[model samples]
Target chain A: MLVGTASVEALAASAPTISAWREQAVELRGVTCLQVTAEMRRAAREAVLPPALHPTIPAAISIQAWRVRDGDLGAFDFVCCRVSCRSGVRARGFTTGACASTERASSGLAGIFGFPTRTATIDFRQGYDGADLRVEVKGKTILALGATSPEPMGPDDVQYTSTLNLAHTPNGLRLVQVEAHHLASKIDRLTAHLDSFDGEAFGDARLRPYHVVSASIASEDISLPGVRFVCRPDELAFTGTEPVSRA
Target chain B: MKFGIFFELSTPRPFSRENEWRVYHNALEQCRLADELGFDHVWAVEHHFLEEYSHSSSPEVFLSAVAAQTRRIRLGHGAVVCVPEMNHPIRVAERAAALDIISGGRLELGTARSSTWTELGGFGVNPDDTKITWEEFVRVLPQMWMSEEFEWRGKSFSMPARNVLPKPLQDPHPPLWVTVTSPGTELDAARRGLGCLGVSAAGYEEQERRTKEYHRVIQQCEPVGGVVNDQVHTMNFLYCHEDYRVARDIGVPMVTAFNVANAHLYWTREAFPTRAYQTLGNAGAAMKAKSRPADDPSAAKGLPEGVGVGDPEHLIATIKRWESIGVTGINFLLNAMEMVPQEQVLESLRLFAREVMPKFRDPGDRSRVYAPTTVPGFVSDPTC
Candidate 1:
């Protein structure tokens, strides 16, 4: 019954464009991901989400930083900001903005998967006791997060929602459903502290992270499969879901 | 096996006082029919801030209204959320006692720690502490009912010595039960010598496993009340019609509507990551993928086993499967989203009572008496 009220044009202003849907899956191995989630203020509950998705109660945001040791685009780090939401009953995240450590990685990701990515200085480190992430744009720190007191848990204990990336495709301007498969060898839950975040640099000024809910670090293999579906940005997913591929 | 009706009191969109009034009155009408048709009990859920999914936040009031309307049908004051913020243990005890007195001792007390962040987070309750808080409430409620002056120095709440007033009409207390939503919670019920009120939609295999574990552990339990309630009451849907297609046509959408509304609630695991909360709870377990194809040969036989839809014959086979696996009783949800017309709902209850219920009980068997003396009762007519 509750639908997001944000204008699709405003949301599409900063979204990356995808020329075509990739038919092949992209694989990255030995990736260390540090994900920090925090509840956002209620004011941004529907202001940041497109109508196709439903904003979660007491809106929340997740900031994830990944260090890819070996991948198709070579060694690089990536940081992305996502607003938590639901895409027709399934939990999904709307990617607000992202930055890649290298130009090659940024261009590759943007072209293949519509990752709203730009090159930035990203330092993501994970040790036994703690994990830390710092994202810098033009020598100005945009986001910094620290997670401590690591408690080991099984990899299956963690759940990852699919990402909805707004992008221009062959069909039209649509929200691409990009699902990823993760096979993790290690996972840890941590107490997190948000040191700083520049919401404007994250593509929206209302994207500020409020109270921290949880943080986790995992060592895993990440696979991004080809896009299978897209939905109209201004309509509900129940009525807007359009399949992009037969498979 | 005992049969009861469960009410979530789901009111669909355009949630107005008018809409809520209609839902309430319609549910009351159904309760009246269930009572007249020899149903054992009527269980009302306690939920808050969950729009459309459940508007029965004040179930004690709702159950009291039912108490005033009907006799013989037991009142299940289910699952007064045993959280300090949502409900103080003292208030829960006092209210249950009052409801028991009002219902003439025909009351079943059900306790639970809520499973939704929509509720726990709304009340500012820390999800990690809910288990311990629920533990304390279950232990102290019986003591409050039995003691003349009760004092508590518990981890979640504390109070000076005070007589929790308005003792229940039952001799010691009402039958104590804990709602089992997440896995392993039935063990908590068993260890506390409480009844297992399963609210989730687990299939026969998983339920049989849980039932086995519950029966085994309850044999050595340290009960939280004067008597241990070993009953296992599983929740189900009811949409009986003589025509099988009619039942499927109407019943599947009601189930889907309830599941979707239930999924809208923000689950505790999604918001707060902790061992205390594991699964998404409720709709997560209930919303299963379509396992059988439409063209499957078994499609003509009517709905699958354990689904309480279809013709009376299908429901009989389904309930027999449940009984085969040791389910003591079942609580049926008659309607959701008001999908079934009021007249049809009343008809479904009447039809099920006439066709399916008799097969389970003897000719002279009547509704179980709630309490020996204080409870004013009803003698069910076999001809009805």
Candidate 2:
């Protein structure tokens, strides 16, 4: 069995604490999500994930930028980068880092959902022809994703896997399972081009995109539910997974 | 219904030379026994880099060995992964032809574009091109087998005109099949007039729906092969015992072992986000949903529906359900991860043959529609 070899301490470095986790579920309407997936350099694949997860073959990464038109935290844009991995048999994404357009959006993401977030300028746009995302931190451009040739597809065509967020919990440092439900109204396949990326800013300097795989944009109602499960970062999920304690 | 044994040649952990040797020898023994018991076919899958789950990477080689041992049983070189990186069209035709000649024209050719990123990425196969490449492979293979000299200028590869040597013993070419793991692939099979070799575990309703759609679509088929192999052969597990509890006691572990091992592979959709791969295509999705801990004794009371497990009666009923859904054949995976001992697997085959198989076998079976029709390179009246 292939397991990740990254140290728990290293993975938790960019993870928020459970102190920010809330039990309330937040639902955002009319969210336009543009996701670009790219295969990462295979040499540093194992170093990007904790031991509880298994790195995908030809290790890959997904960069998702979402534009929220209306939400409890008001309208804001954010971009999240995740390493594709597996927790036991199910597909999961290991979040490396996230950047929100506004401080309010960053705090809401960090305090409510335990996202490892910081305030940054995010330009996320979707039009009839294509979708594009640009992320800038401290007046320096960090990432840019451009997708073209929008081919309409069914809503069920795109699958969003649950995410594993490595965070310091009340109990200990655990990989929290953050599952968001999406009801997509429309979806389009796109030809993706990754113009620039700074892997260092995305929590790991070694996390470089080797090849662009695919891109898609979806109009969806995104819901962030309360945390349900967490697993020990150093052990396999079969033995280490436990239910989240309400207390 | 036609009953066949499928081999993954799943060797246990501590994957030593001795363990691999034991797996091969045991599989040969099982094949010999299956032939003696009047089993119809022996299908071997082609997989790569899938440790413990499937070690039979070179299925043509394995099927040739089985041919040397068995006399009457047909050899199914099931699903040579139809990727340009993994298999060139000419090479696939050459190997299948040789295997067919070795088996005295009893070879059934099955093709597929693999689902796992483990195999595809290992071979450096781009996920987007697999479907197109598979289409090109299937379209060219028959031409290679039938023509004195064949050439192709295609998207995946271009070959100069040359006689693909060692033409198959079967008149035009062997029956063609395509392994259906993804949901819409049955339509691909139907449209191409190839057999639907279902390698995944789908429920009765889903299977019925797919069967209906397949039959509906094949009516307008533009065949990719010499003859339209209008058959639906589902893959399942087989473990029979007089006592249902005992069957569950020994059998559930093997199934669990196989499911876990199958799930271990990184699927295409998980790694490469694309419309090409929508779901994790395998038995892992369907079977894993209802799986309990194999050692959970409390879980061994009733028969799992549609599985070839439990007593002979239960096996009969399960086979009947499949038959009712227009499945022409079933290929059984006898052991996985070598979870069942060699002796026990043999015993299970013997018990199933004696008490369960006879109940379904009929001299006038309608599934004989799948038999070699006198009209070569064409489909007979499928309405029978």
Best by TM-score: 1
C-alpha lDDT (0 to 100) for residue A37 of candidate 2: 83
DockQ of candidate 1, scored on C-alphas against the true complex (2 decimals): 0.37
* Model 2 per-residue lDDT at B82: 91
Fraction of the true interface contacts (Cα pairs closer than 8 Å across chains) found in each model: 0.18, 0.25
The TM-score of candidate 2 is: 0.82
- Candidate 1: where are CA atoms >4 Å away? A3-32, A41-52, A67-70, A121-158, A167-211, A217-247, B289-298, B301-305, B370-384
- Best model number under DockQ: 1
Model 1 docking grade: acceptable
Residue-by-residue lDDT tens digits, candidate 1, A2-111: 67888888877777778777788889889998888888887888888899888876678888888999988888999999888888777788888899999989988887
